[model samples]
Target: MKAFYDTGELACVALDAVTGPQVFLSGFPLAGSDPEQGQQFLLDHAAEHGHCVLYTPDDSLSLTDLGVLLRSQQVGAARLTRPLFVKEEWLESQYFRDHLPLEGGSD
Candidate 1:
């Protein structure tokens, strides 16, 4: 879809997340029938939903700090991708007893 403005900005980024081409997956849908309004509605009522996983890269770190509901919900960030998950599963396997993280949690 053709975006009207720079998507890194708040409104545009929100709209893009609702309707634009996704990098990792496709066919992701918003709550309403119309994409724009659906995004706006969700943003306007963010507290009502659970399991809303917001993925923020370094550029959007400030977003995780806003909104009372999201303030304390920010988990740790990582540069991880799909392969990292596979590697983590492998690292946890019985075959890799020597590859576990250190006692203090440093991997």
Candidate 2:
């Protein structure tokens, strides 16, 4: 996986070079800052690449809120967007989670 954007708090990674169904993660720690920047980045990448699946933590902002933001900006067609809210505990089971260390020391 390659990181597209790392803002010290939130990170946008390219899981693979697959042609369809791109995945972008959110909710690192301080993701609330300038949400639109992240939103636009995802949208632009999705448009250029393919369908985007945004995986955000459950405790973080709601997918509905993201949808609202997307709608406000008129990013793209509805079919190109997919948002999945995941529980924090699930990250522990993901092997890739261990490879990408958090901003600070491991918790």
Candidate 3:
């Protein structure tokens, strides 16, 4: 709800809500955050992975109403850290490291 966004707690609460049209990740890729930072990345990946939205709150809705709205949205799975994990793996791979020097040095 309004308070959630105002307080910047929507992402934390959305983690447990079911995925569906009703629920959507809202925050954009904030400064110091990666390109895919907010709900859009989560929602797109969730749908790609066969998930659904259960509920969503307006940017200014109250957190107290989350459960009811979520239930009504009937949103399914919640895509939390899946995208981060995928990105982490990519960042950890040799292909990623190939572009960097293991130590500080000019090759």
Candidate 4:
């Protein structure tokens, strides 16, 4: 994708393209933090169409808060993957204890 824009005053620039599924994982100074609207759009469209997992590294909010919003819906799951503090073994144990299916054949 090519984006062309002026450094100063902008001119009318328009282009159209049919793109594939886009995953927008971001954090910022939102004019309004409407988790409900954001969640609804992602759930109704992205998650329903197979994007069940969304990885966000935005530090403005806590993982628990985002997790609650994402999992609030019966359809979507959100995970924050960054500044990972859990040890590998600890993660494995936790995964096995909580998400057994993800443990595969590990006995």
For each candidate, what is the lDDT? 0.24, 0.32, 0.26, 0.26
lDDT (tens digit, per residue) of candidate 1 on 1-107: 22112245321122122232333212323311232333333354444444232322221111122321111111133121100111222223344323322111122
Question: In terms of lDDT, which candidate is strongest?
Answer: 2
- lDDT tens string, model 2, 11-88? 333221123134344532112223455556655555665643334332112233232112111123321222322223
**Sort by lDDT, best first: what order?**
2, 4, 3, 1
Point to the candidate with the largest TM-score. Answer: 2
Question: What C-alpha lDDT, on a 0 to 100 scale, does residue 53 get in candidate 3?
Answer: 35
What tens-digit string does per-residue lDDT give for candidate 3 at 1-107? 11122234332222222221123334432112222344445455456655533322222111121221111111233222211111222233445323321111122
- Greater-TM-score candidate between 1 and 2: 2
- TM-score, prediction 1: 0.19
Q: Model 1: runs farther than 4 Å from truth? A: 1-32, 47-107
lDDT of 4 at 13: 17
Ordered by TM-score, highest first, the candidates read 2, 3, 4, 1
Model 4 segments more than 4 A misplaced: 1-32, 53-107
| List of clashing residue pairs for candidate 4 | none
Residue pairs with colliding backbones in model 1 are none
Where is model 1 poorest over a 10-residue stretch in terms of lDDT? 78-87
User: Model 2 clash tally?
Assistant: 0
